[model samples]
Target: MADEEVWKAIDDLHAWLDANKAVDGPEALLLRVLKLSEEVGEVAQAVIGATGQNPRKGTSHTWDDVRSELCDVVITALVALRTLTPDAREVFATHLAGVTERSLDGRTP
Candidate 1:
Protein backbone atom coordinates (compact mmCIF):
# COMPACT_ATOMS: atom_id res chain seq x y z
CA MET A 1 0.00 0.00 0.00
CA ALA A 2 1.00 3.60 -0.57
CA ASP A 3 2.03 5.75 2.39
CA GLU A 4 -1.01 7.99 2.08
CA GLU A 5 -3.33 5.01 1.88
CA VAL A 6 -1.91 3.63 5.11
CA TRP A 7 -2.29 6.98 6.85
CA LYS A 8 -5.86 7.29 5.62
CA ALA A 9 -6.69 3.84 6.91
CA ILE A 10 -5.15 4.66 10.27
CA ASP A 11 -7.17 7.87 10.43
CA ASP A 12 -10.36 6.00 9.57
CA LEU A 13 -9.64 3.41 12.22
CA HIS A 14 -8.91 6.13 14.79
CA ALA A 15 -12.19 7.84 13.93
CA TRP A 16 -14.09 4.63 14.47
CA LEU A 17 -12.27 4.07 17.74
CA ASP A 18 -13.06 7.57 18.93
CA ALA A 19 -16.72 7.22 17.96
CA ASN A 20 -16.94 4.04 19.96
CA LYS A 21 -15.23 5.73 22.92
CA ALA A 22 -12.35 3.25 22.68
CA VAL A 23 -9.87 6.04 23.12
CA ASP A 24 -10.58 8.82 25.58
CA GLY A 25 -7.69 10.38 27.49
CA PRO A 26 -4.37 9.82 29.22
CA GLU A 27 -5.02 6.26 30.38
CA ALA A 28 -6.20 5.17 26.98
CA LEU A 29 -3.19 6.88 25.45
CA LEU A 30 -0.86 4.83 27.62
CA LEU A 31 -2.62 1.64 26.58
CA ARG A 32 -2.31 2.56 22.92
CA VAL A 33 1.41 3.16 23.38
CA LEU A 34 1.81 -0.10 25.24
CA LYS A 35 0.00 -1.95 22.45
CA LEU A 36 3.11 -1.50 20.31
CA SER A 37 5.12 -3.50 22.83
CA GLU A 38 2.55 -6.27 22.75
CA GLU A 39 2.69 -6.45 18.97
CA VAL A 40 6.49 -6.47 19.03
CA GLY A 41 6.46 -9.37 21.41
CA GLU A 42 4.25 -11.26 18.99
CA VAL A 43 6.74 -10.58 16.22
CA ALA A 44 9.55 -11.95 18.39
CA GLN A 45 7.48 -15.04 19.14
CA ALA A 46 6.80 -15.61 15.45
CA VAL A 47 10.49 -15.23 14.66
CA ILE A 48 11.48 -17.71 17.33
CA GLY A 49 8.90 -20.17 16.15
CA ALA A 50 9.83 -19.77 12.49
CA THR A 51 13.50 -20.33 13.25
CA GLY A 52 12.74 -23.24 15.54
CA GLN A 53 14.83 -21.62 18.23
CA ASN A 54 12.74 -23.21 20.94
CA PRO A 55 13.31 -26.93 20.83
CA ARG A 56 10.02 -27.80 22.53
CA LYS A 57 8.04 -25.73 20.04
CA GLY A 58 9.97 -26.41 16.87
CA THR A 59 8.63 -25.02 13.61
CA SER A 60 5.51 -23.60 15.16
CA HIS A 61 5.31 -20.72 12.69
CA THR A 62 6.30 -20.07 9.11
CA TRP A 63 8.27 -17.10 7.84
CA ASP A 64 5.01 -15.75 6.45
CA ASP A 65 3.66 -15.64 9.99
CA VAL A 66 6.67 -13.62 11.06
CA ARG A 67 6.08 -11.21 8.17
CA SER A 68 2.44 -10.79 9.15
CA GLU A 69 3.40 -10.18 12.77
CA LEU A 70 5.90 -7.53 11.76
CA CYS A 71 3.19 -5.85 9.71
CA ASP A 72 0.95 -5.87 12.76
CA VAL A 73 3.71 -4.17 14.76
CA VAL A 74 3.96 -1.44 12.12
CA ILE A 75 0.21 -0.92 12.03
CA THR A 76 -0.05 -0.79 15.80
CA ALA A 77 2.82 1.67 16.06
CA LEU A 78 1.34 3.93 13.37
CA VAL A 79 -2.01 3.88 15.07
CA ALA A 80 -0.44 4.73 18.43
CA LEU A 81 1.42 7.60 16.82
CA ARG A 82 -1.78 8.84 15.20
CA THR A 83 -3.49 8.67 18.54
CA LEU A 84 -0.80 10.94 19.94
CA THR A 85 -0.83 13.44 17.06
CA PRO A 86 -2.84 14.13 13.89
CA ASP A 87 0.31 14.77 11.85
CA ALA A 88 1.67 11.23 12.23
CA ARG A 89 2.26 10.80 8.50
CA GLU A 90 4.33 13.93 8.17
CA VAL A 91 6.16 13.20 11.40
CA PHE A 92 6.97 9.68 10.28
CA ALA A 93 8.02 10.81 6.83
CA THR A 94 10.39 13.41 8.23
CA HIS A 95 11.96 10.93 10.63
CA LEU A 96 12.25 8.29 7.89
CA ALA A 97 13.91 10.80 5.55
CA GLY A 98 16.46 11.66 8.18
CA VAL A 99 17.22 8.01 8.87
CA THR A 100 17.48 7.16 5.19
CA GLU A 101 19.85 10.06 4.53
CA ARG A 102 22.04 9.13 7.47
CA SER A 103 22.08 5.42 6.67
CA LEU A 104 22.75 5.82 2.95
CA ASP A 105 24.89 8.96 3.19
CA GLY A 106 22.98 10.53 0.26
CA ARG A 107 23.66 7.55 -2.03
CA THR A 108 21.44 4.67 -3.05
CA PRO A 109 22.03 1.57 -0.97
Candidate 2:
Protein backbone atom coordinates (compact mmCIF):
# COMPACT_ATOMS: atom_id res chain seq x y z
CA MET A 1 0.00 0.00 0.00
CA ALA A 2 1.02 3.56 -0.65
CA ASP A 3 2.03 5.85 2.19
CA GLU A 4 -0.98 8.04 1.50
CA GLU A 5 -3.31 5.09 1.84
CA VAL A 6 -1.77 4.13 5.18
CA TRP A 7 -2.25 7.64 6.54
CA LYS A 8 -5.81 7.72 5.24
CA ALA A 9 -6.58 4.48 7.00
CA ILE A 10 -5.04 5.76 10.20
CA ASP A 11 -7.12 8.94 9.95
CA ASP A 12 -10.27 6.97 9.29
CA LEU A 13 -9.65 4.63 12.20
CA HIS A 14 -8.88 7.54 14.49
CA ALA A 15 -12.08 9.27 13.45
CA TRP A 16 -14.16 6.16 13.99
CA LEU A 17 -12.56 5.56 17.38
CA ASP A 18 -13.02 9.16 18.47
CA ALA A 19 -16.66 9.09 17.43
CA ASN A 20 -17.39 5.91 19.34
CA LYS A 21 -15.29 6.62 22.37
CA ALA A 22 -17.05 7.68 25.55
CA VAL A 23 -14.13 9.76 26.72
CA ASP A 24 -12.46 12.57 24.80
CA GLY A 25 -9.63 15.05 25.08
CA PRO A 26 -6.41 14.11 26.85
CA GLU A 27 -7.85 11.05 28.47
CA ALA A 28 -8.72 9.58 25.09
CA LEU A 29 -5.28 10.33 23.78
CA LEU A 30 -3.70 8.70 26.79
CA LEU A 31 -5.78 5.60 26.29
CA ARG A 32 -4.89 5.52 22.62
CA VAL A 33 -1.20 5.71 23.48
CA LEU A 34 -1.55 3.05 26.14
CA LYS A 35 -3.16 0.74 23.60
CA LEU A 36 0.23 0.42 21.95
CA SER A 37 1.58 -1.37 25.02
CA GLU A 38 -1.26 -3.86 24.92
CA GLU A 39 -0.63 -4.53 21.23
CA VAL A 40 3.09 -4.96 21.87
CA GLY A 41 2.38 -7.48 24.60
CA GLU A 42 0.32 -9.49 22.14
CA VAL A 43 3.23 -9.49 19.73
CA ALA A 44 5.47 -10.85 22.42
CA GLN A 45 2.93 -13.47 23.32
CA ALA A 46 2.60 -14.52 19.69
CA VAL A 47 6.34 -14.79 19.37
CA ILE A 48 6.54 -16.95 22.46
CA GLY A 49 3.77 -19.17 21.21
CA ALA A 50 5.27 -19.46 17.77
CA THR A 51 8.61 -20.42 19.21
CA GLY A 52 7.03 -22.84 21.71
CA GLN A 53 8.84 -21.09 24.49
CA ASN A 54 5.86 -21.56 26.75
CA PRO A 55 5.92 -25.18 27.80
CA ARG A 56 2.21 -25.17 28.58
CA LYS A 57 1.18 -23.85 25.17
CA GLY A 58 3.56 -25.69 22.84
CA THR A 59 3.35 -23.91 19.52
CA SER A 60 -0.15 -22.61 19.82
CA HIS A 61 0.54 -19.75 17.43
CA THR A 62 2.05 -19.75 13.98
CA TRP A 63 4.46 -17.22 12.49
CA ASP A 64 1.50 -15.66 10.66
CA ASP A 65 -0.06 -14.89 14.01
CA VAL A 66 3.11 -13.10 15.03
CA ARG A 67 3.03 -11.10 11.79
CA SER A 68 -0.56 -10.05 12.38
CA GLU A 69 0.21 -9.03 15.95
CA LEU A 70 3.17 -6.97 14.73
CA CYS A 71 0.91 -5.22 12.25
CA ASP A 72 -1.48 -4.43 15.06
CA VAL A 73 1.40 -2.89 16.97
CA VAL A 74 2.25 -0.65 14.01
CA ILE A 75 -1.35 0.38 13.51
CA THR A 76 -1.84 1.13 17.19
CA ALA A 77 1.38 3.16 17.27
CA LEU A 78 0.42 5.18 14.19
CA VAL A 79 -3.05 5.83 15.51
CA ALA A 80 -1.64 6.96 18.84
CA LEU A 81 0.77 9.27 17.01
CA ARG A 82 -2.16 10.60 15.00
CA THR A 83 -4.04 11.26 18.22
CA LEU A 84 -1.05 13.25 19.42
CA THR A 85 -0.69 15.28 16.22
CA PRO A 86 -2.45 15.70 12.89
CA ASP A 87 0.90 15.84 11.07
CA ALA A 88 1.59 12.16 11.72
CA ARG A 89 2.69 11.47 8.15
CA GLU A 90 5.30 14.17 8.13
CA VAL A 91 6.37 13.34 11.65
CA PHE A 92 6.80 9.63 10.88
CA ALA A 93 8.53 10.29 7.57
CA THR A 94 11.04 12.65 9.14
CA HIS A 95 11.77 10.25 12.00
CA LEU A 96 12.10 7.32 9.60
CA ALA A 97 14.54 9.24 7.40
CA GLY A 98 16.68 10.11 10.39
CA VAL A 99 16.66 6.51 11.56
CA THR A 100 17.59 5.20 8.12
CA GLU A 101 20.40 7.67 7.82
CA ARG A 102 21.75 6.91 11.27
CA SER A 103 21.60 3.16 10.79
CA LEU A 104 22.62 2.85 7.16
CA ASP A 105 24.97 5.82 6.72
CA GLY A 106 26.72 5.38 10.10
CA ARG A 107 25.65 8.84 11.12
CA THR A 108 25.90 9.93 14.75
CA PRO A 109 23.74 12.28 16.74
TM-score of each model, paired residue for residue: 0.89, 0.92
lDDT string for model 1 (13-89, tens) is 87776677665688888987898899999999999999999999999999999999999988888888898899999
In candidate 2, which residue ranges exceed 4 Å CA deviation?
A: 106-109
lDDT of 1 at 4: 72
- Model 2 whole-model lDDT (C-alpha atoms): 0.92
* C-alpha lDDT of all candidate models, in order: 0.89, 0.92
RMSD of 2: 2.6
Tens digit per residue, CA lDDT, model 2, 1-109: 9978999999999999989998878898889889998999999999999999999889989999999999999999999899889999999999998888978896655
Residue pairs in collision within model 2: none
Error of 2 at 47 (Å): 0.7
lDDT of 1: 0.89
lDDT of 2 at 96: 92
